[model samples]
Target: MGTTPLTPGLAPSPGSDGTGVVEMYAGDRASQALGIVVEDFGEDWARCSMTVGPDMANGHGITHGGYLFLFADTTFAMACNTEGSVTVASGGDITFLRPSHVGDALTAEGRAVATTGRSGVYDITVRRGDEVIAVYRGRSRTLPARPAPPAAG
Candidate 1:
């Protein structure tokens, strides 16, 4: 299988549209297990939400930092891959602003800040109602498309 060439601002190939991206991400077991939902998305932007539950809480009865990072990362992935490229996180950092309690609904909004060559930068904000819970910055690198698997008999 040949890799798709990188084209800036190009729509993703077939099955890579906004809805397709959401559908493809639905196969992610970890995200699904965490109850992450892709609420809405467009070119260079995405919004996702997840509710804090007991399983996601830490010893102090607050939402764990890892869960918050995962939420931001998922949103970043959706925002960067909107252009049809197979983008992966090169690096990321997060700052926890406040503790989130169980039953709190967390929403992560990610937007692309810059895209140069095959690399891009994105920022995500996790919020509970009007309260900011966390902020995340992610760097992404676009990789060549993976070869398709051989057809089944």
Candidate 2:
């Protein structure tokens, strides 16, 4: 599959909208191949969903492990990149519980687990229907706050 471009926190610069640019990257395309779509974006959370298909399958005809990781990663990025404090993933760990297969509609959800100064932690969960397929924990560091944009001349 393709990779989805996770939005990187923008630097503090004049005229910056505060919220960094949001774009779909290679990993997103991979998620799209699995039929994934970001359904919601919020202050401290993000939700993504995808329908499993043959294109998402590995040699064994099940959803590939990478796909699951991407799903959690994307959600983690979204949750960490909050307003005021820019977030970057410093580390993460994921655990797979069961195999997800074709025809399963999987949803990845992420939430803030903890925060300390410029660093924050997020938890991500991947589920098919009501079954939890994977769980992930991500650590992120927020850069120093940027100054607001200067007024135009």
- Leading candidate by TM-score: 1
TM-score of 1: 0.82
Q: What is the C-alpha lDDT profile of model 1 across 1-153, one tens digit per residue? A: 021111224444333366535455746677767778777677878788888888889999999999999999998988887766678899999999999999999999998889898889999999999899999999999998789999999
Per-residue C-alpha lDDT of model 2 across residues 1-153, encoded as one tens digit per residue: 342333234232343232532543233454555555665556667777766767668998888988788878877876666353557789999999999998888888888878878878899999988899999999988777789899999
Report the CA-based lDDT of candidate 1 relative to the real structure: 0.81
Clashes of 2: 9
The TM-scores, one per candidate, come to: 0.82, 0.71
Worst ten in a row by lDDT for model 1: 1-10
> Could you tell me which residue pairs clash in candidate 1?
12-84
